[model samples]
Target: MARITYIEHNGTEHVVDVRPGLTVMEGARDNNIPGIDADCGGACACSTCHVYVDPAWVDRLPKKQAVEEDMLDFAYQPDPKRSRLTCQIKVTDAIDGLVVHIPEKQI
Candidate 1:
């Protein structure tokens, strides 16, 4: 399993173990991490799992899909360079220490 860390806007951090094929959103919601409602689960329909990937790790993940790209428009903390839908980020060794930050609120 890969270790994923989510740092909240106020600096609180949540750590969880994730399976290789699971999406980050799944790990968060399943593990009961805060701020990730994942109302649409991992279907890429809701922006509730929106997060900001550390700039250092941004290039290490794949590009978001059109569905994720579109849904991100609903997030309260959208940032073109950093905002991403966590459901679109699959677990991989390259992201074992992956740390994404959740904004204070979601739209």
Candidate 2:
């Protein structure tokens, strides 16, 4: 399992141990971290799972794919530099201490 941190817009923090092969979205939902709706259930078909990758960990993640980029266009207040759909990010041992910041809203 990888230890990941989720920080909410209002400054709440949730640190969870996420299993490998699961997406970050799953980590939030399974751990009951608020703000990640995952309306499409990690299908990458919706933007409700949007979160901002911590600047320090952004470079360590895989580059965004075209589908994720397109879906992010529907996200509220999307930030190209940091906004990401948690569903697109798979948890792995390599990212043991990953930190993600939740946006103010998701729809």
User: Which candidate's lDDT is highest?
Assistant: 2
Alpha carbon lDDT of each predicted model:
0.88, 0.95
Model 2: per-residue Cα lDDT over 1-107, one tens digit each = 99999999999999999999999999999999999999999999999999999999989999999999999999999988898999999999999999999999997
lDDT of 1 by residue, 24-77 (tens): 999998898888888887788888999999888888889877888899889986
Clash totals, every prediction: 0, 0
Whole-model lDDT, model 1: 0.88
Worst 10-residue lDDT window for candidate 1 reads: 37-46
Q: Best TM-score goes to which candidate? A: 2
Instruction: Quote each prediction's TM-score.
Output: 0.94, 0.98
Question: Candidate 1, residue 17: CA error in Å?
Answer: 1.5
